[model samples]
Target: MVKDECKTLLDALNKVSACYRHLVICVGGTSDSQNLREELKKTRQKAQVLASANKNKLTTILKDKTISKDDRAEFERLWVLFSTCMEILEIDMRRALDLGQEFPLNVPTKHLIQTGMIGRTSAVAARAISVQNMKYEEGNDIDTIDLNELEQDISEVGEMIFEMEMKVNVLQWTVEAKQEPGTELKSTVSAGASSLGMISVHGDGNKKLCDTNKVFAGAMFSAVLIFAIVLAVCIVKFA
Candidate 1:
């Protein structure tokens, strides 16, 4: 019985070993993010089921009256390692899940101009108004903000915000007992994360994102004001 139980425990350990190795490869290699994520999830689930089965088998072995103390102790030691491995896999799987949910969408949205943060937001806002004026150069003052690697860093921050949003949603559901899906809920989460992600990127440039936010709002209002003036002129000329 002891020999049989030991074999079962060893088999479960081997499965866990294979899963962890695959996870590492997926994370660092150039594979589809969604596919890799699914694989990791399956691996974690399989490890958990195997771990439970091994635990039950060990319990049976320990229950046998003829089993010696040394053999029972060996089985118990294997169980501890099995339990620990399962726990570690669970933690990693959770991190991946938290990243994928909450419609946070990392909405990194579009490329942002760099001039908005520290020195001026108006210049970039004006240039953006005209497609012909929008230009980028590596060393130019009007260069685009954030490199691909930097974008990845912002994505990591977005994931953190996603986690925060999930906790807040759970708390809100508990308190209000309201899980109704509203159209705006999805947009709100996406916009909030997008705005926050922008702030993070801008902040890295020694500038406050709020400064840019105010400038943007001001630009929109200005455009409206100018359009209103033009409409008034047209009305007066016709009148």
Candidate 2:
């Protein structure tokens, strides 16, 4: 009976290994990006199904008081393999997605240049207007700002904001997983170690995740508000 569960997990890991090989082919530029993302979506769904169906049963086997020590050790060994393979699958998916990369798009060079020019021009105009309103003299200026440098800074901040948002989403999932009893092992299988998997199945972890998400929300809101204000000012000035 214990061997049966181990076999199930091993089969799941084998499927993931096959999926990972296909993912590598997609990531190697032989396949289009859309196909790559689609494959990942499908893989995630399969993982969710596999975990949902088997996770509780596997846990039951391990936590049974009458389970033999040898069986327990074998199950643990297979569990580790399954967990590590799932983690690797998730990492490769994220890499293919370029989770924190700028733009995450394949826009044409011409369009990108045109957009950058317009934004840079509008930003400079907005800055000039603000400086003028502040009554800064030509000879004794308060500060000089470079539009290119400012744009780069804003882009970096935006990327950081996006990364924070992703982490917050993972934290929320972890908290919810803790709140549900049967979902603990399933969540670990589906979300990998960096997300719902590594989180403790404890109420304290749930509370801590919630608190951290709240703090992240407040900080993210402030940053997004500031960016929105700047963007609005540029739009108004340009218009």
User: What TM-score would each prediction reach against the true structure?
Assistant: 0.36, 0.38
Residue-by-residue lDDT tens digits, candidate 1, 1-239: 65675776666555564554445333322332333333443344455456556655655665577878667555555544554454554455444444333212222323222222233222323321333432333233211122222244335434533443343222222233123457549889899999999988878765666778889999999999999999999999999
Q: List ranges where model 1 is wrong by over 4 Å.
A: 17-32, 102-239
What clash count goes with each model? 0, 0
The superposed Cα distance between candidate 2 and the true structure at residue 124, in angstroms, equals: 51
lDDT of 2 at 183: 61
Model 1 C-alpha RMSD vs. true structure (Å) is 26.4
Q: What TM-score would you give candidate 2 relative to the actual structure?
A: 0.38
For model 2, residues 77-149, the per-residue Cα lDDT tens digits are 5544555455555555455344313222253333222221211121222221232332223343111222233
Best model number under lDDT: 1
Residue 206, candidate 1: Cα error in Å is: 57
Task: State which candidate has the highest TM-score.
Answer: 2
Give the least accurate 10-residue stretch of model 1, judged by summed lDDT: 141-150
